[model samples]
Target: MSATASTQRPRLGVTFWLLAVALVALYAILVPILAALYGVSVPVAFLLGAGMCAAPLLALWYPRSSVAVFTVAAFVLPLTVSPDRDPVWPWPWSVPALILFALFVLTLTMQHGWRLGSLALLLGLMGSLAAPLLLPDAASAGAAGADLIVTASIATVAFVVGVLLAGRIRLGAELTREREHAEFERSRRELVEERTRIARELHDVVAHSMSLIQVQASTARFRAPGLPDEAIAEFDSIAATARSSLTEMRRILGVLRTEDHTAELAPQRGIDDIPALVDSTRRAGAPVDLTHEVEGEISAAVQIAVYRIVQESLSNAVRHAPGSSIGVSVTTAGDDVQVVVRNTPVPPSDPGTPGHGLRGMTERATLLGGEIHADRDGDGWTVSARIPRQPAATEVSATASTSTSTTTTTTTTTTEGSA
Candidate 1:
């Protein structure tokens, strides 16, 4: 245990012992006063007071006999201790003490537990009050009654304060536990979601790489017997493709390991890179028809959105319906760019392939304040994406058109001079 806790144990023990001694002392002093006021003989009064003190000691040593002894003495002692030589209707000054004793006994019965040194202290107190009533003197019972009332009132107030404080402590502990549990659950959920997102990213990046590797390896194996030189070239291509894929995969994985993600992500590919995307698809043995109308500069965010939409749509088509003829279109009208990718469905050969391509495409578009629609059109699936464009930075188009006209006039003049 820490030094503080170790120190607290002895302090608490000392406090309990001090309280016990105080209770015994208070009872011992009060009993003699009460007995003298009621004119009891010194010896008898002392004996009676001593018995009251001994009751709690008995209760401390013997738990079973303790409560019974305390209860019976509480009720019988007051009646036995009359105030006057000739007993009268008004009982004695000891009545109030008896009442206090009964209430203390009731508390004992209700608050019973393994160790209650505090309650034992209170019992000794009640026992002390019983001494005066057993005396043979004539005394005013009203004053004694007032003292008992005051003592009981103070105890009741203390009990209320204690209960309120305890309730507050218990409530605070419960809230702390609940908050900790919530934090734990939140962390667990985030871990699961991060793993799932990484899996998706890995599939998208590595699948393309693996496909290239597979094609090259197959070509090398098939050409080995017929063309030795070409087969070696194919093996080299396979190794290069695998290495490229490995590099790209590392770059993608690194994005997930940091708090600042801007450094980890590659520059976004966009509509301008559509030619490259088409070339890749064509190399993969898919027919791609391209339609381009947007010529103006576009925002990086919008371009990225456009690129992702097309990328996901084409990826889905290639995986779900290979060898399908795809038509890709891009058009910009004022402040908006629209993309459409449609592919004719291929004949089903492979089984158990489900469609998540459309969902991925939709997720990309929706994240960028754009919308994508993928639906069946006759014998094909068509995906259309519309993204809002950013405003132009400058009127570079006007300057370019004016320069082109000047060049045309100059060319005409030169032609006339040659003639």
Candidate 2:
């Protein structure tokens, strides 16, 4: 058994208390008979029986020590308390032996695994075999020997049965663990397969469609003669944006397709790209007013997180609240950047069910050690996020320090030469 399983305390259930009560009752019954057989006072027999019975209770706390205590008691009890005249040598040992055997079996079952149980069985069998040697006279020795043989046979059978049962229990536990591990492996394999299928669909269908859009937008001016210069410039911008989106899509797909994919050659977009995103939204017929007051360099991860949150919020507004003026504000204080996006409410309509867009935004923010809140504002819906900028701030500070040290050295050298 594992160390964790072995060291854990056993629960004291109803059956445990019942067994303890039964043991005390058995001692009560055996004490009177023992006193009568030994011609001893009732109190002395009760004391000896109580001591033997109590030894087993110690197994509840210290299983190995209790087994030893009980085994020793089994041998010593008969020797100390002599039977009455015309004694049957084994009769006095019977009650103590029964208690010892019960405790031995109980300990074996309660403890995990087989090693300890096997040891308990071995000690009990040895104790049973040696019981006849403690007989007080040769005449009684013959009767004790016969009793010993019968008792040892019963104990041997009990030991074999206990070992078999313990082995079965261990086998069951092993099978349960194996089944759970197999289920986990199956689930992980299915997830990876599902992700790969999604990557393939996006690459084949979405990427191909985007590529066509980029190609058509790039060639539109040349194919249609006499196109206005402004129209040509618009087409150029469309092609550039489409190409950038396709590149980003490819990087994402590559990651899904392989575990060891390399980083993309192009840098990821950050908070600085939010203005361009807002401009695109405006071109798409959503009037977006953006206010950005962030004052320090932020990590690329935090930038991406902020950009995605704003993008999702704007997309939701356009889909659900078209013609509504959207307001996006990004501000930074100390090592934290806050982003709030709100849109004026349109006429009440089916808001549609909430879905992955909001959840994805929340998850992205959380991964960056930030938090996002999305709720209904007065006559509008609002989404806000707070992100940490400490990583980028540290890098920027280190760079500034290096530059300052270099300038100081140059100035010091120049001053000394001039002196």
Candidate 3:
């Protein structure tokens, strides 16, 4: 009953309201005029007309009000017709009341849906048919039965049509929403498939190559007889480097395979690990000097970025400026950490396509809201970055802290195993 009393609908806007108001004014004038011709009195005729006009407009937002008004109007208006006339609705509700009442039924159906519409339709039929039976002049009135038939038939048709149109409109809106959801799901599936394919390619090609390097470097001493101590140490350093690279490659593959957060197995290298990294390069017979200045604790994310920036720079130096005195300097000032790596410029011997290292460094700095620069400094090439301290993506520290964490750092426990 609460729902039937009134429904809150989206306003059809000013133009629609203006059109509806005009229609109501037209019916308001004509119904009373026609009722007066049927011997209905001045005051009663206008009251009936007002009831018919109000029923339809109220149906738009107030179902119970429309039903009450239309039901009463349908029953009372019929008895007002003169028995001398063709009582088949008199001025015939056929021309006047029939259409106005039908409008009420049609609007009710559209606004509140069919269940309430059916109720209104049923009640309208009962009221319209019952009124003429109570008419004192109904017995002698010609075609009075036909009047009831015509009124019922028109209202029923309006109800049936309203139901069909409402169902079609509702179905159309539902289908549009479902189509949009399906399209989004399809796009997401394609993105996940693309990432999986890239991970598979790296595992098959890059991982296999790094594994071979580790195996060869590990077996070099046994393969060649009477190798010098320095050369053996160099081979051991190469093997360690290969193992470390393979480990890092596995970490990258894990990220590419899926978007989910997975447990990290090993600790990442950072500022403290810089000394060991330089020692390994020195053992490989490349002259290198390192300097550092730091105060207070730094975040794991910044530490990892700093370590990778330095590592990539050292790598570029060894390739483009081999056997040249390379300088690595790292320091912290306030909230920012700065790194500078310089080496003798290549002797016009190394010139070709650029690598992804510089791009990688720039992207890393940008992600952490920082900056990186690579430029030629006199006869030397320099790569530098100024990265602000930021929290890590995960709780895992860049380097192990306690006795228990140290053991996990060396253990291979990731989903993507070593190369």
Candidate 4:
């Protein structure tokens, strides 16, 4: 229970006490009147009158209208049979009781707050005690004045205490509701954040790898006629790469809630992975032609970009025009790697086909500060990407050797061909 309930408990105790006092007071006032009118003894009259207070208690325990109604009834009962009742007009003790009952009834019906009915009932007690004083009889005035001061003061204190207690109860209930709401919002926010993180990781992983695979597959198809066994080996490598990429992607997303604190898994495909990508698509039935002009070892970031551009274009060819031939070219010029992929026009294909090939490629190229274009070029669809590369040892070797001795170049090409 809240503070309101705790405080209200004492008020309840006081109300009951006041009720007892009212019964006794009315009984004391009635004994003389009953004895004079009906010749009954004081003891009998008092005993009989005291028994009437129980009616109000019963009503209260049963809770008919409001506790105040029963309480007022208890106070009013003695006024009805008082032998001092004047024929012209009775001592208006019943008026205060009625007023108390009305106030309680209103409070019960409206129930706006704690003040109205409880205070009204307390004031009624005061009014009842003061009634005889206003009659101008010295003895009656003195007795009524003393009685009113004592009883009203006690009842008023009880009413005020009850209101304070009730207010506390209301405050506690409001706080509890607010606490629950805050907790719910916190849980919901955590769920949203978790989902967003998963999405970002997925986008980073799948798009990059898929683009590399597509480009390598295109290269393998183009070089297959010139070199068969070597190209076939590349195809096998491409399959393994694809499967590995798929596996890593799944693992990253799987252990989201568990924190093992491992270093982030390195992305499986970089720029160098393009050869395997082209090889895979060639084996998958889309004939891809690839040519590369690079100085030497391209930077990993630049390699990844070139890989994605060729990959997306080739993947688009396979998806949008399944049997179409694709052409891929990569030129690493100083600070940039330019890659272009063009495929035969797709015959009227189904518009509803769902393929992530294009989206994956686009996401990859964009991440590396590169751009891709897919449009109609004469009789086929063409995709192109330009990526910036950092100068490295492999870049110098790849570029310088392309222009030098034929034997060294052929041997070098053959070696790259074998790989």
All candidates in order of TM-score, best leading = 1, 2, 3, 4
Off by over 4 Å in 4: 1-268, 291-313, 329-340, 350-378, 383-419
Per-prediction CA RMSD (Å): 12.4, 17.3, 14.9, 13.7
Candidate 3, residues 1-419: lDDT per residue as tens digits? 35534234444355248638756776766565565557667777778777877777777667787799878887787677666654433423546667776777777786679988988888877886666567656544456566667777888899988888778867976898799989998888767766655554454345545544565566667656689999999989988998799678767876776643211212366677777766655544456777776556676666666777777777667555655677888877777888898888566667623644565566556656678999888888888888765433443333323211111121111121111
lDDT (tens digit, per residue) of candidate 1 on 1-419: 44654553553465346535744775667476546544556665565555554454443335346555554454344444434534332333253344334333333332233134246436544654564455425335665556556655554554444445446656876899899999999997677556545644564555554654543353444434566777678677776776577556646555543331111112346666776876776665566787766656566656655666677667667656755688888777776779998988755464424433455455545544567787778878888987666623241212111111001011100000000
Top of the candidates by lDDT: 3
The alpha-carbon deviation from the true structure for residue 134 of candidate 3, after best TM-score superposition, in angstroms, is 2.3
Per-residue lDDT for 1-419 in model 2, tens only?
44553444454455458768878788877777666665546776666677667755655556667668666656555655554344553543465556556555654554434566566666765765564555555236667666666666665566667667767767877999899999999998767756655664465346545655665576666457789999999999998998799779868876776442111111245676777767656655556777877665666666666776787787677656756788888878788879999988854774644544565566556655678999889889899999876433332312122111001011101010000
TM-scores for all candidates: the values are 0.53, 0.50, 0.44, 0.39
What shift in Å separates residue 170 of candidate 2 from its native position after superposition?
A: 1.9
Q: In model 3, what are the clashing residue pairs, if there are any?
A: 89-92
Instruction: Rank by lDDT, highest first.
Output: 3, 2, 1, 4
lDDT of 4 by residue, 1-419 (tens): 44654554563575557666765565565556555543446665555444433433333333333454444544444443444344332233333333333423332222225545454455456545543534444235555455455555555555555566557757886898899999999897667656544543464446444644644564555544666777778776885777566556546555442332211212345555566777766556556677755665555545544555565566557655756677777666666678778877667554423434455455545545566776678878777776545534333222122221111011111112221
In angstroms, the error of model 2 at 302 is 45
> Candidate 2, residue 397: CA error in Å?
58
Residue 64: error of model 3 in Å?
A: 4.0
TM-score (C-alpha, index-matched) for candidate 1: 0.53
Separately for all candidates shown, the number of backbone clashes (residues 3 or more apart, or on different chains) is: 2, 0, 1, 24
By lDDT, the better pick of 2 and 4 is 2
